[model samples]
Target: MKKERQATEGLVGLIPRAGALAARAGLDWFLLALIGMILLAWLFPELGVDREPLSLGDVANYGVSLIFFFYGLRLSPGKLKAGLSSWRLHLVVQLSTFVLFPLLILPLRSFFEGGEQELLWLGTFYLAALPSTVSSSVVMVSIAGGNIPAAIFNASISSLIGIFVTPLWMGLFLTSSSGAFDLGSVMGKLVLQVLLPVVLGIVLHRYWGVFAERNKKKLRIFDQVIILLIVFTSFCESFARDMFSGYSLLDLTALGAAMVGLFFLVYGITSAISRLLGFNREDRITAIFCGSKKSLVHGTVMSKVLFPDANIVGIILLPIMLYHALQLLASSVIAQATARKAGWEATGE
Candidate 1:
């Protein structure tokens, strides 16, 4: 069965173009852009916050739907069905994403029980609840000569599952922490803004899937623009409301350190789990890369829905943004090393 699975690994081709692009994305550029957004927000808060002449937030809300629509359009139903058959691989990746990550962080809640620090913990928890990213996960796995089919399957399926699981996990504390969390209203907005558009895109895929795929690089840029807009406006509100007042350089540095540690912890555990489950080299690589990533796209959009306060949202999104950047930095090096090691082994050096 293991050999049979290995034989069918080419169900999808390794996307070097995407891998190269993703590798560049994992570089410091995006992280610098994120920091630049914050600085811009700090300098010109009214630009994003003011709604008199225009509102970037409204534009972001519309963009969010379109992002998900393209997200769904790219999802090939036939491939999804095939991926479903690999129940064990899917189970490990999904569980590691939604379950193991959260469980690891849950223990530290005591250290940050209340105050501004509590919000940091909440942000960390939010990071844990998010689904794995689609592009980077698949890209890194592909670069490592992993199971491309399963990587695509797990990454795609994780996004769909996150639309539901993320909120449910968040609701556990969102309502209690802040009265702004109206689960019913929030989910309704997500259904219309996130879910419905995705369904529509999927239904229209046969007609437009090629378009979406052909223009995905363009669409991804669009996604990043919308996200930057969202981030800008969100922090604009945060700055206006003095959300980062309590957080100093040290505080942020500590949080950033924690985010790095969190990624390694999850990565280490998933690797161990893959070994214990007797996954093949390819399957093991897929599990480790896919299981250890989190979706910044979902985290950004969901923060708008989950935490209504722009002031609170800066803190809410802080952890994910940091984790996203750090994960990319760390994963790029790891992926390259893994690829090199594999090559060395294959060549019997």
Candidate 2:
């Protein structure tokens, strides 16, 4: 019994060290956590799918609201107003996130119509229509020595804009995709689950904002845990219905490749637009990072509300999940490279 206890303790102790090593290696821990959750769901599908006494979906729903609440608490209105002067950067980032992305995907609809691939295409379009990531986009811009204030402003504003715009964009064709999409219900839920919490947090920011800012790390972890729960339960529901059976290895590979290509294309376009606008390097990096990111957290939460049908929800999430992972991997590398270049120049190297 002593030896058995020692072995378990040793195994537990190794995990944090492994995580630190992964961080040192530039391997994203969230990606690994996501994979672990998916595997766990695959192994014990009943836990997340079976609506037991403890339902993960319900927990995730509430957790998502809290996530947004904290997000609001962290966003200072003064900072937002201060950064509003950078309208050029804001316009480019917002346009890239909403207009350019969906437009880029629109032309491919005909190629995917009347087949199983239509779902994939719709999912990809949904991903495009979603907002820029709040946390990672800012983090990447900060790392790249970009305009941090502009990055924060754009990312926060993007999320706020998406609360309205994403549903509007998806509403145009969601009926075609899901046979019926109740824009009213989706809007209500967005207000309740996403927007309302943000408003509440913002209102209370004066009292608790300092506390929230101090514990940003904890809140981020909390956010990630909620996301993982959502991902696990989502995939569990998907596995329960065997929704992934139709997806071949080749199809997944193609999806990943498409995501990679889309990121680069958007990145290139954003960079060019910044250059055309006579943006400094800092503004360009902020625009590129903020404009190129799509929020998986928003995608997953909105999927729950937008696509009420469990079966299709998984299909809708696939592209976003892939894009989420791809962006992190690509953006981190770019951010590090940009930082290194800046450092070299600073040192006259």
TM-score of each: 0.91, 0.92
Candidate 2's TM-score reads 0.92
lDDT of 2 at 229: 92
Model number with the top TM-score: 2
Query: Where does candidate 1 clash, by residue pair?
Result: none
- Name the TM-score of candidate 1: 0.91
Question: lDDT of candidate 1 vs native?
Answer: 0.88
- lDDT of each model, Cα atoms only? 0.88, 0.90
Over 4 Å off, model 1: 1-25, 178-180
Model 2 steric clash pairs: none
Give per-model CA RMSD. Answer: 10.4, 4.2
lDDT of candidate 1 over 170-234, digit per residue (tens): 89776666656677888888889898988998898899999999999999888888899898999
Model 2 Cα shift for residue 178 (angstroms): 5.6
Residue 35 of candidate 2: its Cα lDDT? 84
lDDT of 2 by residue, 4-119 (tens): 99999999999999887666434677878888988998888788887768988999999999999999999899888877899989999999999999999999999999887888
